[model samples]
Target chain A: MSERTAAPAGQADGRTDDQADRRADRRAERRAERQAEEGERRADPRRRNNRAWLLVLPVVVSVAFTAVIPLMTVVNFSVQDIFSPGDRLFVGLEWFRSVSRDPEVRAAFVRTLLFSAQVLLLEIPLGVLLAVSMPRRGVWVSVTLVLVALPLLIPWNVVGTIWQIFARPDIGLGGWAVNNVLGLEFNYTLDATDAWITVLAMDVWHWTPLVALLAYAGLRSIPDPYFQAAQIDGASAWATFRHIQLPRLRGVLTIAILLRFMDSFMIYTEPFVVTGGGPGNATSFLSILLSKIAVGQFDLGPAGAFSLLYFLAVQIVCYVFFTVLTRTGR
Target chain B: MADIRLEGVGHSYDGGRTWALRPMTWTWRDGRAYALLGPSGCGKSTLLNIISGLLSPTVGRIWFGDREVTGVPTAGRDIAQVFQFPVLYEEMSVYDNLAFPLRNRRRPKAEVDRRVREVSRLLGLEEHLRRRSRRLDPGRQQLVSLGRGLVRADVAAVLLDEPLTVVDPAMKWTLRSELKQIHRDTGHTLIYVTHDQTEALTFAEEVVVLNDGAIVQAGEPSELFLSPAHEFVGHFIGSPGMNVLPAELLDGVVRVGDATLGRASVELPSGPVRVGVRPEFVRIGPAGAASGPVARVTGVDRMGAYNLVHAEVNGHPVIARTDAATTFDAGATRVLRFAEGRAFLFRDAVRCGALEPLDGRAGA
Candidate 1:
């Protein structure tokens, strides 16, 4: 048996050696062919320029018309004092100084900062809590999402109108509930405190849903494996939220904070509709003060200067915010 | 550490109408490594989740060292699990990721520090301790996850759900061996779930082979390979698996096609049967041998250490894992022989017993 096996084994070894040599030769030939093809392709310059810029031409043109031209017009207005339709004086920096020293403008600037701070402080945490509690899957998820997003879909002026009627002390359901059920004096048009509270409430109602929806999308993006891992790590619910969900939600929260800050800093329509900058200047934000100068008072020079400063403030705040967030994320 | 006992555990994602896992009872002995091996969607992960208390079985009680823990939440059960995809707190340093569980349990700062350092060293993550976990490569991230599971001294068991799936191919074997070594040093009741047979055979002392939401066989790796209790076990355990051929049992001998090749070692009713033999045991010889069936060679695959000769016997294809020194030309006729005492007969897809090869004159 050993002798017969040895004869066949020896013959097979010799045959395999020959076969392996031929296979190696074939592989080397294939490699050389591929390298030659790659070299030829590298020498072709036209292949490198795929003419991708044509796809972006529309966007460039649209942005120049919508953003750049308007920005230049604002810069042009900020340097001139126009007394009439065709009479204008280029009194550079004088209008800027007058607007900066106006007591009402400074007070409105401070009020705007306070309002944005309060909105971010109240809405971010509340939105995150709502997002965390929302159903992750099932029919209820779609239903809840659609219902939560209803406030954001309402027209801005319509939202102001809805709240104006809703906060009246006489007939509206909310006003009736507050005054009749709880017997509290609640007229947004009467007291400055009431007007401020009503405006804040309306803003939160309209925009907190946007934050919640963004947060919910962020929460949904986290895979189930992380939650499973957290459970197996013996983490408590709070611990899971702190260590897993919150870290994952950081990027979305930064965006939500910046968005809420900018929008609230430039708040005009809702407060103007609800309280007409109200019983006093209590609820008047920066945009309201700017509108008062530009349209109500028709002081275009000072208004343009204020608009530029407001734009600068928003840009600086967003830049600082983005930097702080990205630095801590690392 | 504690032994985990499942008493008639069953789960149905659709509320008792259809089950993801059929009701079954099994015990994992304390301080031993066990593997739950199966193909994808075979309830291995479901079983792992039930054991870890992340899931509650629809109809059974789970016990850990004689205490019923079916009602316990995952945190209350004192078990750790590593997921298939590495799940690290990306915002944290490797040290912080490893220390999270210990810190959550409110362990003392000194003990937490000591264990964190010790586990980091064990996983070779000491140098990357201060680096953010998400910045590390996937293999290192998985190591940090494993280190977190090992950081707690009081953990009863560590469940791994294909923890090396995301790891690079070259690092898989190294990480697997390291995991086995860690199991030895830590003595935790480890339950590893995977679809890879090589991983199961090498990592676990005992392997439970599951199929279609049921365990077909559970035994030592060698026992499973040598004497499979079910046909699925024979088919699923080996590379190229076992060759199952149609055969007949007449009187006391087993006949394939027209040739009587062997006798059954155990009593089998005289009727149709399936003969299963590993590829390694099937030998090929020159055509027109005194005994054995004639097969037509189809192909020969040159695998570095061995050549797989593909042939057809009685119209059924069979593969023989032969040494490179055995050669046969395609389309040539050859005689195939089954090694004595290595063949098995199956009745109704369940293994009946072994088969003993007969001498050439037995049929005559």
Candidate 2:
């Protein structure tokens, strides 16, 4: 087998073989040299200057244009005044003083704080209980979770509008049923206490599901081994929650609390539609007050200043919450 | 201290469509460490969960001491469990993690501190008390769970369910030994679950070998290793598994395809059966014997200390452990013979009481 094939291949050698072999060898040498050079290039780790930030430059610019620019404009307007359309005068802290002394602004601040606190206190525990009781699997779980999330998807204005008509004493189901069946006169438009309670109930109805959903996701994320370990440790149900479940859910719960607080603090649409911040400004939170100053009065100078201060207050609260919870590692 | 008894304990997952654990009875004495060993999905973890009151048996009763506590809740049962993954409060310090159970019971501060320190010393975690459990490595976090379970000695029992399955291989041996030492010192009725035979054999005094949700064998570790009652047990217990050869029964003699598989020296049943012999018992040498079965070498796998010689005998794969010093090229023909009385014969999958004297299904 070797002799027959070897004879033909050897016969074709001669001068062509010598020239072809040299050319092939040189090409091989050049290729090897190029590879070696490439290898050395890769080996020099310090030479690579990863310009990855360039990829996110567009995102940074977009955020600056849409968010940071407007925010800065508010800040600028807060410290200055336009005497007659475009003629500016710097008043410094005068607007802050005027807004702080205004009973309307003071009332809004207190109302916002009370609303946020009340929502947080009511929703957190209830949400956690609902989450713990919810089944972890099967078709029923999917259905229940989807249903719970339905209210969160409704637009704020629509939620307000729906509740407004539903709570009318003459025709609305809630007011009419309560008046007829319970024999009580509960009118949100005429009573401050009634308006406050109505607003709280609306906020609870609209947002409790969010906290429950987040808490449920947190519960589901806990590994089974933890429960097993707790069982072996002879821990009671409450102990398990305090020691294992609560700690594991801390990050999610913090986020939940912050989200609920921020949303409740800035709540305007629902109360505005339902009671128009009335029962005599009983539910006029800071957001509503800013809108009142800007749109109702059209005093852009003082209103812009008030809005900027409002933004700073919200930022400060969020920043403080973040720092305290995160730095202490709770 | 108490003895655990499971009488007629069995479970079905789909209302009897599939059984997760078959009818089984066993007794685990107080202060004795026991291991339920099996492969994954072999119902080892299920059994552990049942014993811990995390699962209820469809038909059975579990007793701790003289009391029938099968229907008791987990909180009332008093069994401490260490999970496969560490379940720690990430927000709490290791100190808090260890003290949580004691605090829940409203134990005195001094007693809590003493117990926590003792467990911390035992686990070498005293210095890490102030660190958050989440910041620790998975191994150390698991140790905290272990410490928590061990913190209360007055508890009924301690159950560990494959706790070392997630541990690093380098640390596995050390932790296994530590667990064994802890058991020895505490004298707790420990029921550990693991699929790995080595861990079960080394850590447990008696191993309950399970397969397909049934108790195939239960005895001392050596007994199960030396005399397995079922083909599954024999295959599951040993490191390399037993070599089973299909054979025909004729006039009380077992014939492997063509060649006779030595004498049982013990009685034999007349039927189609399998002859079982461990790879360690097989003798291999050059092909000039002119006796026993003639085998052609197929390949060799070099284990750390020995070579697993793979060979084909009459078209059947046979494995034998050859000495590290011996060398054989592929395709080389070699003669193989089993030790005189080591051959085990199985009818269907159950050990026939006739072969190898049965040995009472030792080495569980």
Candidate 3:
């Protein structure tokens, strides 16, 4: 049977280069024929273009109305100097340069970076510690989760208002306690250090729970086998945390850092309500500075330029953070 | 290596109301491979954890080479374990994962490097030592996990909880043989836990069969096959397993239905007894041949090398294993005979003794 089949195949290959080229042509023809047969076999009336975009058309329309239009307006304002409603002059890159060169804007940019750094440095470890110490199972798990998430549930402006009242030296409990119990003359209204500390504390109180909740989720996702294996491997508590827990929590911690960084860098409502960028502009972060330019001074060009720069800065940081996290994760 | 002894060990995830592992005592000798074989949720993992000190047995003491380690944490107790799923330090390289245990014990860098290289080479992970552990395939990751367990020299016993469960099917056999070779070479006191009978029977020197949180039988693979101490063991060990028939014991003879099958080696109590014989030992012949009890062939399953003949003898189902040469048609009458000396008699589900052929017509 093999010899009979091979005879024709051998005869077909008896010619040299010319025959080989003809055989190749035949092979290509066979392939094309096979593909056409397959295409015919797979042909179905249901294989029509459904145009699924119609389903999401409402969402797209709303997003264009809410986000795209406002962003376009900002971009438009950014490249032109708008003196009045209809009085505008196209002046590209001038506003961006002025905003970048302003000493106050530079100070606020630096302070924003330092503030985000401080928030991350303080909140990440504290949140992880809180998550680790929280009850892992049973009735108390829900209770602890709710309690930790309590601050995150508050509206940002409401948080600012609560802290505003809570930090008043004459009436509030915190300021009164610090003043009378510790005998340290503390007043956030007049002192730059006091204002910075109060703003930092308020930010920590409000956002640390977000980090804690994320870390808790990360901790919970780890299977019990890892811990059991670590225990059986004779790993100490610190070793287990360093090798097992921390490495496992890398993705979550990265997200938490990114979230806290962006949120803290663009913090506005709470500090604005509580400090009002007061105590000689001590707690004036980027958003507060941006608000003062856009609303207080009505400098749309510089504020628009600053907003774009801020958006780019956040994107760059997030990209770097995400890349570092995923690379290390692998 | 140290011998591990469990005295009256029992565990309860709940506080002593119900037991996951019933109170039992056993000893694992030094430098030997043992297998804990059971179905899922049979407390095999619970037992492995108790021995490894991951779980404190509620009512017992554990001793390692005469030192009581019942109160010691898992880290303090000298043991290593590989889990069902590979538990590698995902961020670490294969070399670091193998070195982790030794480094945690503060072993010198030189010693850690030497042992890591040695075990990695042993597990065929020498070329991939610098690669991140999580990037490897599941089989290689599991090998890395096994290497981590093997790298530590001071552990009393290495506990493996179905370590090959996640490995690919084609790789499982190779890994199992490699593990067997590793056991022979290292002389480590290894306790492997698996639900796979093939894995248990082939890998371990002694197999402890468990069912419903209690040990059914503990013996060598051949002994388990030949003389299963419990009916569960008889049913669980083999592919088709042993066929258990309800019978009556009167005088010295065992009667299944109306046929006098054989005589018990020991005088069994005059009551109900289950006669068990492996399918391989159940012989089938033409009916009315004056050879053995008669049965009707119900079905035949051609399983490649052998044919499994399912038959009914006086309303009781029986399975006889025959080679490809032997053929049986469904609904045909045949004579089924239990091979003498291979037939087991069980009283109240516990094995009593074997049955001897009454007349000398064993192979007829």
Candidate 4:
């Protein structure tokens, strides 16, 4: 049966059948052309490779280089000790114990923790309230924003120097006004309690704007419709703030907390310049204590160990805060 | 259960020196659906804001029931507003989003839960109660926003500001009908704002049309459609808009170029007049069928559902919405006649002239 179907061996009848075969070949070619055209319509290659990863790779690389590398280096230094050039020593838990027992280190740790908590309690709500009370969509808004951001522009070192002179007992305006005009016995250099007040005042003056700016951005981003919805629901003013404004500002408030906490924990500049950790170590925070260990006493082993412990403490607090914030907000 | 009254209430941003909303005096009775309809920048949103008590009027006063609430803040005024864009606490779960207002008011937790569950069922969000609002689609997000507004039944009024604009086309009809159903279910005084005429006409019992910064017309939907107070409203409310023709008012007759429309004398100031008529009211193609001026067909567009026939009468372009059954070749010279009493004449853009006979009326 297969041989008969393949029979082009004959002459007259085979030629006639061959002409029919040529016609069938033409029909099959036409069908294939139509199928090819249909296939072209069905699949489009241009739309498949529109991946946007190429555009995002540079940012990923930059973050890794800048953030990840320094963090790993810090981790490495935290666990190891260096003695002289090209020499290393690894004493497990030795330096950690020594630093933890040091009286000065323990005092600075407690002081730093207390200061950060105080600043956080005072600033967050005050900043949020100020933002809520502000007028929306007017010339006054622009003026207010510029005024609030002005203090934030002054350099940290500059702020410390300015307050140092300003709080002088004789020549400085703030000192003279406090002692003479208000009739208060105030000497930031001579009194320990006065030194604490001056340091707190300086911190608030320099950093309140940061909280205010974050909170203000959050408040302004709220749509007018939300307020209208709250009104229709018969919510009270405090109710509106608690439900709408406060919830909307949670992310920014968390950022404000984390940044302010880290910054406040490591605060050394303003207090260092104002009293030089004077008044009998009244305002010595962790950073100042660590600097004293490394530069003043020249004890690299204990100081580096102490610095590592301080870093871990700050990181642990910040990590706990981040976890709590992400959990509640989600 | 309170009726709102606005007696000549107006607002301006720059110390009342420049007006954003011209004087508006109206009342919204209890349980009625009212819509403030306008193009963008026409002060409809401003009026909605003022009524919500988020903004105080620069002039006049607003009253909720008998008590004037012109000086109250948004929180003190018991009103609900749904915005064009959904505004929700993205970090919160659907349950918390609905319960927050109640919780903040120091309501009992049991009451809050009951209210949240009830609203969730109403909005078809019971299954997604545990999910965060930010994870929802834009449609679901808008539903969350709407649910937040509608959860409390004791609110004085519910103000919706183009709430359905962000919704996809396929979901709009269902959502719109759902809103109408919600209104029927709960007799809350509803004030809806939209630029889309179809949504406004279908959802609202009374429609207020605004232009520039003033209310051009306010009436029932049918009345506004049949007789617009100003030329702007006449052109704005209809699809494809009304064809405005330059005309001259002589005595009582309105003349378009060489042709004239026979009507009663108009008591209008003598100046340029514009003749207005809806496309459906204009009859074309050898029109001895109606008693009006004649026109020539200029263009014909065969839509799948209907035929939009364009014509030129007395050198002014006239558009006619004809039945899909009527087939006319493009550029065919056809007679155009106006349906008797369906024509309107305007002077200086205001309806200062006489109206034509009503469309489809006897002997029209």
Q: Which model scores highest in lDDT?
A: 1
The DockQ value obtained for model 1 is: 0.56
Task: Give the range where candidate 4 chain B is weakest over 10 consecutive residues by summed lDDT.
Answer: B355-364
Selected candidate, larger lDDT, 1 vs 2 = 1
lDDT per residue (tens digit) for residues B94-213 in model 2: 998999878766789999999999999999999999998889999999999888888886877788888997789999999999998999889898889988888999999989889999
Model 2: per-residue Cα lDDT at residue B190:
89
Task: List model 3 lDDT by residue over B1-364, tens digit each.
Answer: 6789999999998898888999999999999999999999999999999998878899999999889999998888878899999999988999989998888889999999999988988899999999999899999999999998999877788899999999988899999899889888888899999999999999999999999888989999999998889999999999898898888889878888777788888976787788999998998877877656689999999998989999988888899999988887789998887776788899867899888877575433
Task: Tell me the lDDT of model 2 at B355.
Answer: 37
| Per-model DockQ | 0.56, 0.39, 0.59, 0.31
* Structure candidate 4, residue pairs in collision: A232-B79, A232-B80, B252-B265, B286-B335, B341-B356, B341-B357
Looking at candidate 2 chain B, the ten consecutive residues that score lowest on lDDT are: B355-364
Number of clashing residue pairs in every model? 0, 11, 0, 6
Whole-structure CA lDDT of model 1: 0.90
Tens-digit lDDT string for candidate 1 (B1-364): 7788999999999999988899999999999999989999989999999998888999999999989999999989999899999999998999999999998889999999999999998999999999999999999999999998999988889999999999998999999999999999999999999999999999999999999899999999999898788889989999989999889998769888877778888777799999998998888877776566778999999998999999998999899999998888999998788877778999988889788866554531
Residues A17-106, model 3: lDDT tens digits: 888799999999999999997887689646556788699999999999998999888999999999898899999999889988999989
Per DockQ, the best of the predicted structures is 3
Chain A TM-score of each candidate structure, as shown? 0.81, 0.79, 0.81, 0.75
lDDT of 1 by residue, A173-250 (tens): 888798899989888788888888888989999999999999999999999989988987778899889989999998
Candidate 4 or 3, higher lDDT:
3
Ordered from best to worst DockQ, the candidate numbers read 3, 1, 2, 4
Name the candidate, 1 or 3, with the larger lDDT value.
1
Least well predicted 10-residue stretch by lDDT in candidate 3 chain B: B355-364
Please report how far candidate 1 places residue A111 from its true position, in Å. 1.1
